[model samples]
Target: MQQTILEARHIQKQFHDPVTVQVLTDITFSVNKGEFVSVIGKSGCGKSTLLYILSTMDTDYTGELLIDQELMTGQSDAQLAHIRNEKIGFVFQFHYLLNEFTVLRNVMLPGLKLARYSEQEVEHRALERLKMLGIEHLATKEAYRISGGEKQRVAIARALINDPHIIMGDEPTGNLDTKNSEHVFEIFHELAEVHNQTLLIVTHDQGFAERSGRIIEMEDGRIIRH
Candidate 1:
């Protein structure tokens, strides 16, 4: 039996910017444990929108979203925040690390915020994540001092510090050069195959999507292929 990590049911979203525009329509999908799912689509195709909804960051949509089999449709803002911190790890294109902070500190932020463990434990976990990403040597370096590729690796380490159920990425390798992109892809691949981690990533790179465990193609606010 397969274990589902995330499920979206009959999701629909509309944006009223002077005129109503349907951004997503009836988007339904389920990502199972250890699955590396990639969502690919052209701009304005609603793939990113769907990701936001699934990540519990966008709550205006109509539908049911379940993470770890718990309904997330109507959770309070505080509750959603807790859920996000505890269950979902996010990696964006820009990395978003605070330039002034050390790489280790950046990774420890989420774990500290969650407060599930003591600060010492969080620091230990952050170092472990950095070691996993092969960047433990750079842990004390300032985030701004690292190369772009290394910064992305730090972001990945930070995402893993909390041991999230699913890691949601938005064009994680979009800003990297070919070599770095491939490196990031391989990391994600190993994470799924060896660690049984669930991942849902949105990317415009067809090659990246093709290499993932599964691909979900989107068009005109709907899933055209799964």
Candidate 2:
């Protein structure tokens, strides 16, 4: 049986304004190791909110979350941060690369957070990932110098540098052209199959969602039954 990499139980989240706004109600799901899952929804749905909660970034909700046989709700703030940094990789719609940093440096930035690897080791690993993704030639280039697709590939490399068991992406290909989007989606599939990384993507594109092993539809802050 495949190991469960991440799971959410009875997850509930609400936001407050002049009136209470409920975003997710009893949302729950689990991701097995190396599985590729995609959640699709319209804008204003709780897809992003669910991703944040499941990824262990936001803890304002109430419920149980487990990662690698560990209970996430009981973890201290520092412990949660370490878990996110070490075990979960995130890619956002915006590339989020530092303008002044080169592609290689951008990829290696996350490695600095973990102390075990030597600088040379970090460089070697980053280089290998870049080459594997066919982005090695752009390593020394500034962030702005790369195309939208290349920037997304570099973002994926950054995510992989942490050796994360679960990779989360929010509209990772939204801003790209059709061809670029297809390529980026292919890379995400590669991440799941080749590297055995559990992948979750939040996307408005049904095409991308359909490509995943599982598709979750979200609407009005809840997962829609298909």
The global C-alpha lDDT for each of the candidates, from Candidate 1 onward, is 0.95, 0.89
Clashing pairs in 1: none
**Residue range with the least summed lDDT across 10 consecutive positions in model 2:** 217-226
Tens digit of per-residue lDDT, candidate 1, span 85-203: 99999999999999999999999999999999999999999999999889999989999999999999999998998899999999999999999999899999999999999999999
Off by over 4 Å in 2: none
TM-score of each: 0.99, 0.96
Please list the residue runs of candidate 1 whose C-alpha ends up more than 4 Å from where it truly belongs after superposition: none
